[model samples]
Target: MMKVPKGKTVLVKGVASIKGECEVLGARLNFFECEKFVPVFCIEDCEIEINGEFRILDGSTIPESWKKLAKMDWETVFLYGGVDSGKSTLAAYLANKVGGAYVLDLDIGQADIANPGAMGYGFAKDVVSLSKVSMINGFFVGSITPQGREAKCLQGVARLWKELRRLDGRKIVDTTGWVKGRGAKEYKLAKLEIIEPDLIASFEGKPFDWKTFEVEKGYVIRRDKIDRAKARFESYQKFLRGARILELERDRINLKPDLFRGKDVTQFIESVLGV
Candidate 1:
C-alpha cells in the first residue's frame, strides 16, 4: 500500500484496492478491475494497494472535455466511438456523476450488463464498470457481433428503448465500435433514430447529421482480438453459471427464427442413415 496525497491522482489499469476519501469519475473508489484504465482522484490522503499496474500522475488523467460533458444536463445521451475509443468508460463516468442514471449498454460484443450475445440496461448510481451493475433485463441477439445480425440487434435496441422511455431519469447509451463503411453507418443511424438521444457524444468526429459533442479519446487501453475473445468467453461462462434447462410447450412460447417453420427432415435424415 502506498500513500496518495490529497489532490493527487492515480490511474489504475488492473486489479487494485483504494481506501480513503477518493473518487473515480465522481464515484467513490474502493476496488476496480476492468478492461480499461480507471482514474482515482484523492479527495483526501488515501492508501492504494495495487495488484496489477498503476501510474501516479500529476493530476487526474480524465480529459477536460469529459469533465465538461459530465456537467451537461441532458435527459438522454448517446456515446459514439470506434473500438477502444472509451465509450464504456465515458458511460460509466457520466452515470456515476449524474447519479441514478440508466445505462443502456448495446455493445453486444463486449457487453457489460449482459452476456456477449445480448444487450441490457441497468440503473447506475455509482459504478466503476457497467459490468458491476445488475442487469434489469436483456434481449438476446444470439450473436456476439452485429455483422449479419444487424436487423435482430436493431430490433432488440428498439424493444429496449421502448422500456427505457417509460423510466423517468437520465439515460446513457453506450454503443459498439462498428462505425465504418456504409453498412455500419446505416445500422448506427437506425439506432439513433430509435433512441433519439438529446445529445450525441461523438468521440471520432461527426459520424452522422445530428446534434453532437465532439469528445476526445481519453486514457484507454486497446485490446487485441485474442483478448476480446477471451473476455467474451469468460463473460459467457459467468453468465451461464448455475444455469438450468426447462421444457415448455411449443405453442405456449414464442421462438425467434423458428427452425420448425420449414418442412420436416426427420424421415429424410433417417433414410440417409438407414436408421
Candidate 2:
C-alpha cells in the first residue's frame, strides 16, 4: 500500500496505498472496493488548486468538509448487534470515555443494557436504558419491501431516536437486533436513521452493510465490537458474532472533548444574560 499524496488525484488498483502529492481519482479492483468508500473519496470531480494546497485524505478523524460535525450540540453514535453481541459493553466503553453521556438500549425485545442487578460504573456518563413491551400487531404492515417495514419501524424507532437525538450531552444508542433477514437491508435502515449522527456502528459477524455504510460516510467503519462484546460475559457465551460496533478506542480517546462535553454552567448562565 502506497501513501497517497496531498494535492494530485491518482487511482490505483488492488491492495495499494497512496502516498504523496495526489488524490484517489478512481480505481478498479477485487476485494471490497466500495465497502467503506464514499463518493467524496472519488477525486474525479476535483482540480488541484494553484500553489498546491495539500489535503490529507486517508484516515482523517474529521474530513476537511466534515469539520462542521465538530460544532454539533450533541454527537450521536449508534450501536447494533445480534443478541449478546456485546452492544452494551461497547456502549459502556464509549460512555465512559465521553465523560457522562447517555446510552439507549433500544433492544426493546431483549434489554441487556437494562441490567438491573449491577451496572458497570466504568461508563463515564449518566445512562438510561429502556425496555418496552412489544405492541400487538406493531410489526410493519407488510413483510414486503424493506422500505415499508422501514416506514413502520421508523415511527417506532423515531419515538426514541428523536428524543435520544436531542439530549444536552453526548449520546450512544445501542440498536436492536439484525432481527431482519438481510445484512444489506439492516445496513440501509441503520444509515437512514442516523442521518446526522457523528458515528453509526455495529459489531462484527452480524450482517451489517459495511459496503453501503462506507460509501455513505467517508471514513472506514471501525469494528471493535467483537473484542468488546467478548469481554462482556453476555455475547461471548452465546457463540454469536457479525455485529458492527465501531470506534477503535483510539478514536474514542482522541475525539475533541469540547465537541462532546456540552456547554459549561457559566455558558448556560451567560445565555440567560446573567452576571
- Which is the leading candidate under TM-score? 1
Best by lDDT: 1
Pairing residues by index, what is the TM-score of model 1?
Answer: 0.85
Deviating ranges (above 4 Å) for candidate 1: 13-15, 31-36, 245-275
Q: How accurate is candidate 2 locally (lDDT)?
A: 0.38
N/CA/C clash count, model 1:
0
Q: Tens-digit lDDT track for model 1 on 174-239?
A: 999999899999889878888889999999888888999989997776799998999898888889
Pairs that collide, model 1: none
TM-score to true structure, per model: 0.85, 0.35
Q: Cα miss at 175, model 2 (Å)?
A: 1.3
